[model samples]
Target: MKKSSIIVAFIILLISVGWILSGQIPKKIEEEETDSSLNNITDNKIELVKVRTEKSVSKKFNKLINIQGQTKANRMISISSETLGRIIMINEKKGEKIEKGDLLFKISQDELKIRIDENKARLSSARSQIDERKSKLNEFEIQFNSEKNLFDKGLSSKSKFANAKANLDSARSNLDTAKSNLALVKSELDLINNELEKTIINAPFDGIMTTGHMEIGEFVQPGSVLANFIELDPILAIGYVSEKELKSFSLGSNAFITTSLNDKIKGEISYISPIAEEGTRTFRIEITILNKNFLIKDGLTTTIEIQGRQVLAHKISPSILSLMDNGEIGIKIVNKESIVEFFPIDVISDTNQGMWISGIPDTSDIIVVGQEYATIGKKVDQKLIN
Candidate 1:
């Protein structure tokens, strides 16, 4: 019986050892499961990313004005003749530069020269006649004085004195008439000379002449078209603005213009038409474009843009616009529970900077990147992008 008891004890001891070993098996399995779950979490973290983002708010809405326009030279003109005469010499050819008062044509001066010479001869003869009349008047004056002295001395008759005085007066009047006649002839000659000179045409301003109306010896009438000329160095851009856009445009506003002909011009508002067109309800605005290079030609189609509207917005790359679930147009935002939140924004203006949003806090930090991946109220780790 003692031996039987000893065998039972040995069996119990073996079973105890087996039980202890069996207990370790569950712990090992639990440890392996924990390690596997940790690995899985790490791998999932790579699949999703936190997109950095920013927030935008609206300040004040700015209005934009758009307009269309054409270009023209600042000064353009057609020359004309002042009198009817034959063109003697043509100084300027087509496409020639001319200064102000530059002679463009001359007329035949044969008649004018003869008229000038005749006036000179008449003036000389009038001077000689005036000298003779003056001498006669002087002699008559002396005779009248002597006759007056004789009458005062009672040695001459009153009739004789009166006759001497009358003679002096006549001579004086004749001399005056001759001098007046000479002056009139001289003035007539001057007027004719001016009229003759008017046969020659001259440039009224510095410009380029496009055409010469008459050749040498061609007779032109007064007010005939001589040539087409345009003043250089400054040009004008004529544009029309809608009535709504005219409010933003005023004198001195900066503007830019680009033409289809590969010319870029910039200028400021030079004029704004006071009256609006009754039909189109549009107003005219002008910009004086500088032509320093002399490369810009007239009548080029152009585009104009105005700056400084005082807009408040966020600068996002154009790619940031996205679609939201339930089809509501909104951007992803952050929530209290490490979750994503989305809200619709009132879009004021979409600009090169970004979308100007209303209904968002001015200080709200928004998610800019990875907005589509995270759902509303879903847990996430957010990173900031300023």
Candidate 2:
């Protein structure tokens, strides 16, 4: 009975110890679970923020601007004579449409014709002399051959054979001289004919002569003003562009205009001078304007406006266009999180309504109202005002 009581006491002590350890185990597990739940909640708070945006592919814009210009002629050239002679026959009258190789004026026979005739006679005489020399040389050669055979056969003397040989050599030398003289005379005749041909002046281009300075029996030399020829259908409108606005235009830029008397006229930049004019410091530009209806005229006053590309669709109060934080002028926009981002855009051109700019997107939703209050990366709700 004493041993069983001792065993029962030990068992009671072990049960109390186990019950206390079990209570601490449940508390430790609950504390670990609470700490893990707090950690999870803290980790979940650290990652990504919410962003909301709407996106859609828009239709491509075909932007057209109104540019002003004038109609101009393509090209104009004056016809001039290459030879110095009097005008004998005026083939085409003034205001006549002529093509290439058309005859204009013809001159009568002058000293040039006489010189050509003389050269031709000289050439014919020289040819006749050459023919005579050839015949004479042939006769001398036959005689020389006969004498040489006789001398070889000891029937003719060496003196007679030498005389025949000398006569043949003389004929041959005369023939060569005649040929050279004929060649020189032929060349002279060709040059005279060329000069005679040049006496007839022809139209150098396809156009109408505005004014004719000479008539029949008029003596004109090279470089003399013969006629003022100009292209009839189109005319030239000359103008100068400012040096500051040099970069505002380009070759082949769009230009348009309308006259009070004429309809709408369209033109493109045809020429831009590489060097600026010294007096005006302005670059000279030529635009090829068309005048098909025969409306445009020379020396007509015209207004020209070179068109450039447009930029920026954001609307702003006209007051803020020139506003500056310090001294630099710029506009501010909002980032993804409604943060303000200020950037400078050189105002290349501006109208009474709005400003055109570069270095900006084609379309931007700018923060015009709260831009002064916003900072970069500051999150705020954006009001859709477009």
Candidate 3:
């Protein structure tokens, strides 16, 4: 009975092992079939990159130069005294607005009037001497004529006639000397008047006085700066341009100016430096902007927009720019063959809408989306975005 029981138990264990093996064999076959199908799909499939494109339109755009500069007064000058004297009166103060020929300061008229009066007296004395010499010359001429008539008629000695002629010549010389002295005295009087005029200083032009508060009794010399003056109307906008950008500029070109305070003004190119700056190697450009109200101050930082020639350009978002393998910045486009191409661009100007760029085809289809996946000179599957 024990032997029969052992054989039956062994048959039951063998049936369980056969059932487990039958289930695992089918599963292994299914896994192998799945792996084979995946390999077939991978081998013969083409990789396609999806990208969005836009049609570029050719349009005329203004080429512009965006630069920074500073404002300057149209005319700046240091007013200096032309003569030496002591300050007796102060007519203007610093920061005062003055008109042309306005008195700025007064120098002490030390002995100026006395000198002029002395010259006048000397002129009077010379005039009286001139009249007396002329009367004596007339008397000598009459006597000489009488002596000459006597000598010609052989009625008088040659010595007597010669003496009379010498007297007349001396009188004429005295009269000429008197006239010269009169002229000299007159010139002296004129000099004194000119010096008197120099005692008072006046403004050269219509401007604001930036300096001068000379107190009374301050001694000043020739060429001593008495005040600072500036003309603010029609202010100057000065900037520098590089060598490459020099060709785009010309005198009288129109420009737009903006101040740091968001003030926009219109201007024109006034002066272009003939020589380059020594340190920067750049040419200086000056623009004239009307400031009739004198609202603009000098030395304030400014932004200048100088318009250049009109050229064909494309305006696009800045994100569309890409970098090539050579580290060049550009945009990617689709050629006529629907293949990817690269074009380098120059940024002309930036606006609120977009960046204006040059150096692309007049008309092109540019990749807008999935541009990272697009390779230059490769076929692409372009997808347009609405």
RMSD of each: 16.2, 16.2, 8.3
> Per-residue CA lDDT of candidate 2, range 86-153, in tens?
88887655766666567777877678988887887888899899889989989988998999999999
lDDT of candidate 3 at residue 214, scale 0 to 100: 57
- Predicted structure with the largest lDDT when compared to the true one: 3
Give the runs in model 3 whose Cα sits over 4 Å from its true position.
1-51, 260-262, 381-386
User: Once superposed on the true structure, which residue ranges of model 1 sit more than 4 Å away at CA?
Assistant: 1-54, 57-66, 307-386
Candidate 3 lDDT by residue in tens digits, 185-228 = 99989988998999988878877887464567888888888777
lDDT of each structure?
0.74, 0.67, 0.87
Which pairs of residues have clashing backbones in candidate 1?
A: 53-368
Write the residue-wise lDDT of candidate 1 on 43-88 in tens digits. 8854444666565544555534445788887899887887766777
Q: Residue 359: error of model 1 in Å?
A: 12
RMSD in Å for model 1 = 16.2
* Most accurate candidate by TM-score: 3
C-alpha lDDT of candidate 1 relative to the true structure: 0.74
Deviation of model 2 at 301, angstroms: 3.9
